[model samples]
Target chain A: MLRLPKFEVKNPSTVEEAIAMMHAIDGEARFLAGGTDLNPNMKHRLFTPERVVALGGIEEMFGITQQEDGSMRIGAMATLANVASHAELGLAYPALSQAALLVSGPQLRNMGTLGGNVMLDTRCQWYNQTYFWRSALGFCMKKDGTKCHVIEGGSKCVAAASNDTAPALMTLGAELEFANATGRTRMPIADLWQADGIWNKKVAHTELLVAIHLPKPSADQRGAYGKLRDRGSIDFPLFGIAIRLDLDAQGTIFDAALCAVALQARPWPLKKAAALLCGTKPGEESFTEAVEQVAALAAKQCRPMPNIPGDHEYRHAMVSVYTKRALLAAANGDGPVHHV
Target chain B: MRVFRLQVNGDTVEVAAPEHWTLLEVLRYKIGLTGSKQGCDKGDCGACTVLLDGVPTLACLSLAATVETSAITTIEGLLPAHRANGGEGADPVQDAFDRCGALQCGFCQPGMILSAKALLAKNPNPTSQEIKQSLSGNLCRCTGYTQIYEAVVLAAKGEQV
Candidate 1:
């Protein structure tokens, strides 16, 4: 039986109170969202905070509301199920909806929050193990040991970014709002992550993610997401691709964004591939060329370590295959953006 | 210890719960409602599934203090309601499961039945694909899900299980 270690839980009625409580705690503490990721990690002893500031009681930090200018502001506490099933989000940002829906399953979706998904911990086979399992293996740099198991004698941890919604949100150019005891700040979602696995996110420990701001979708905008995993559900992505495109009046691709996840410490934006799509005519010949170029670029840019399940080489190859599938779906406006 | 007032199975019960106690622990150990099994204890398995405000949620991941305001309905709560809803004396979901031979070890039954009930309540006539998607969170090690799917379909049609 996996029993949670004893810790004090602080429930605050508001975000301001939560931050103040977090600041007041003398020992190490963690913000508790849905407890989907944090609870499991706690059970594994990967995280052993002395105090937990529970955010579920804050009423202001929940729900999805549309702005006057047509954009949407999603509170950090909004459950994945709520975000995925929201009528506006489903129509405006299908990739976001699909990514949220594809995360874990129904029961988890009910408990897991959008904020938690966006800030999900980077994962690796070597690190995401029980305390006994990891302790016996002589813990890696991610936990307690000196060296990285994935990249022998490597200085930095190379855990893959396993967040499913991150790539999709990056493709849509989403922004995040964060608050702390001092003040509040907002930044583009792209700026939230760094390349280092051990300290992957740019957000400070004191800052709490408050909400996600999604810009209104243009009439000509289309987006899609595809993820590669062993199972249809519950498993995190071995590799995932998200593509967002804007077509001009002439139906030519004017702007495009491509992002890949589970390949490295952070989702990599395939700038070269998006550049190739710009001004390209939407046709079989153009798509084929774009696919080839994007695949080649991804294969060169991504260095998939043997951190997760599936053969590294096979997973690397699927990056291109899935990218092409996502681009095609975005262009064609398909329902099932996700592929096995 | 904190005393939380929870509406469980139509009863307003107050229990002294620890700050870290999950709804699953409170239900099984404290409240003695063992119908909701603790399978993985993580959210991966649906064995600890229960209805929180009419929506299926994992009890193992839900904090007892956080969910005090909401009505919690466990598998045991479904029985009388199911009978009242013209289930012919037995709970419709349970009757369907028994009639369809949907259990081998019967460990996954409670969660599966609740998931199916939630689905049927929202979408009475769901397609095969929808049924599969709805129960995708549930893991049945014994049955291959064919019988369970059939049971849900039968229950939706109001047929005797």
Candidate 2:
């Protein structure tokens, strides 16, 4: 049986106290939300922090509130189940709901929080491994050694960013609220990620993601999210696609945002696809071409590691399949209001 | 280390454990509640399924500290009489399982039953596809899912074996 490394567990009722503890412990401390992801990673000896500050005790970070602006402010610690089952979220942001529902499973969604899903560590077949497996392979850049096993002579780590919610949130132009011992700051969701794997999450070690702010969707706007995994349940995505479209009275696509997840340091906005679909009607042919183009572009940008779960070649192929499905779903204007 | 007083199976027990100790470890090792077995340790398998505040959860993955104010129910808490006394001679689910030979070894039955109980509590009537989808995380190598689906359907309708 794998054992969790020894560490001091601290539970703070308030976010301020939690931030202070993080600052006092410095980089030796790590925040624990759902632990659905962090606990397993810790058992693998991926991170041996001296202190684990439990954020699950903070009640203030566990609710959902609607702003007067028709936008919603979701507490970072809100469980994925709460987000997926929320009536307002299901109505306004079907893309976000779809992403939330796709994570792990029903039991995990009940435990995992929105913040943890959004701030999910970048994964690669090579990096998301057990200590024994990594040691046997002479270690990769994201872990102990310098050589990147995914790509020889490559300058960066090729760990896929396996976060499913990032792409959906990015497509909706969401904002993030971050807090630390000093104070808090709000920034666009797109700026919160780095392409680099080792430090894909751009937050300071002390700062906690406080909330996610999603703007209300316009009346004519429609969006959807799709993911490709080896199996339907409990598997992380090989590739994920989220597309949000704003249509004019004539049903011509006016504004389009396309995002990709689990492929880079963070959710990457596909600017080229958005530009291609800007003035187009996104008919059957146009949608197919746009999906094909984005899929091809994603294939070119990613050098999937042989490390994760499925075949790297298959993952590349799924990028096309998922993108095509997401575009078609958006074009057809058929997104489920909620899963259950 | 923190000592929490929790009511498990109608008994109030105080367990002294590390703050990060998961409820599964406490239930199995500290308190000797061995019915909740650990198959996958992670939340992937329902082998360690238990009720936290009446909601089914993976006890192996749930930290003990998180349930300070909530009620916890384990398989041991459900008496055999209770399982048999569902307005019938024997619970339709168990009777169907016995008739259909749903379980060969019975290792996964406790978790599978509890998960089914949780599902039926919320959705008394569910389709065969819904039952399969809900129980996807619970793996049973023996019956190959033929009898489990029948057991769920029979239980939902309160029919005799």
Candidate 3:
């Protein structure tokens, strides 16, 4: 059994209280939402904090509210299961619903939170192992020691962002609400990430992700998420892509977006590829050709590293496959293109 | 060490353990309810699965102190709760697994049965795909999942075997 290192847990009833509790014990505390990702990482001895400010007890961070403007405010503590099963969410944000559903398996989805998935730690083959396994390799730059096993003398850590929902949220142009001892602030989700894999987010540890605010989709909005993995479940994405398209009254795509993950520190936004799909009709030959171009463009832009598990070459090949499938799925208004 | 009360299997039992100890650890080591097997003590394997507020949750990832407010049902709780409700022998889910030859090695059945039990409680008649999805978190290495699937379906149908 992998014993968790000793730590005291503090359950705070509100976001402000949780933030204050974290501020009091800065750098020695981690915010525990669902404990699905953090607990396993903690068991690997990746983080041995002295205190864990549990946000599960916070009532304010547990609801999904509809805004007067048609957008939605999803609390950070909302479990992935709730988010996935939400009927309206599946209709309005199918990509997000599918992404949430595809994370790990049933039990994990029940316990994992969207906020935790958003704040998920970057993963690498040399980093996510048990202490002894990593110790034998003299550790890596992301943690413990100073070596860079993934890139060999690379100064920056390139641990892949393995979260499934990141690309979907990116495609949806989501905004994140955060709170701290100072004040509450909201920012576009895309601006929250940095290139640093050791710590990917721009926010401080003391700040709590209060909620995820998704803008109301336009009437013509459509999107889908496609995941490629060795198995149907329980495994992280070997390759994942999300697609969004908006059709004008002419029944042609006016705006489109594609974002991908499981390859880099941040979700790679394939803006150029998505732009190629504009002016193409959804069911016409032009759209099919545009999708192929988008897939090929994604294949060219996404360079899968051998940093995490799975073969880089195979992952690279699947980029085009998943990209095309996701684009098609978005057009078809179907659920995510998952093997399961 | 921290002393706290855990609402386990409908009983409010008091035990003392370290604050970081998971619910699985306290249930097995402290309370000696070893029916909840500890396989892959992280969240990967569902062998540490238990019902937290009637939802299937990974007990290995749940902190003992944090889950005190919720009703926790472990594998051992099933048969006793069944008996209390006037059922004969083991719980139907457990009995189904035993009859369907799904208990080979049995390292994963405790969690598998618990997951099935939760699924049946919610959706008494689940499709094969639903059954597969509900039990996807629990892996049975000895059996290739056919018998396990059969067991869950049999239990869901209230079959006599």
Interface DockQ of each model: 0.76, 0.50, 0.89
Task: Encode model 3's per-residue lDDT on B1-161: one tens digit a residue.
Answer: 99979999989999999999999999999999998889998888799899998899999999997898999999989988999999998899989898899877989988999899889999999999999999999988785599999999899888787
By lDDT, the candidates rank as 3, 1, 2
Query: Model 3 Cα displacement at A329 (Å)?
Result: 0.6
- TM-scores of all candidate predictions against the true structure: 0.97, 0.92, 0.99
Give the candidates in order of DockQ, highest first. 3, 1, 2
lDDT of 1 at A9: 84
> What's the CA error at residue A207 for candidate 3, in Å?
1.1
Q: Clashes in model 1: which pairs?
A: none
- What are the runs in model 2 whose C-alpha is more than 4 Å off? A282-307, A335-340, B80-96
Residue lDDT tens for model 2, A1-340: 5567777778899989998888786548888888888877787778888888889778878888999998899999998888988988877887888888888776777778899998887777777667899899998888788988767977887576777788889999999998876698999988887768887877775689989999878877878888777666777877777889888888778898888876656676788767777666767566667667866775666555564677878877666666667877877766522222
Which ranges of candidate 3 are over 4 A from the true structure? none
Which pairs clash in model 2? A125-A307, A125-A308, A161-A262
**Between the candidate structures 1 and 2, which one is better when assessed by TM-score?**
1
**lDDT score at residue B84, model 1, on the 0-100 scale:** 65
Error of 3 at A188 (Å): 0.2
Instruction: Say what the interface RMSD of candidate 2 is.
Output: 1.8
Which candidate, 2 or 3, would have the higher TM-score against the true structure?
Answer: 3
Quote model 1's iRMS: 1.1
- Ranked by TM-score from best down, the candidates are 3, 1, 2
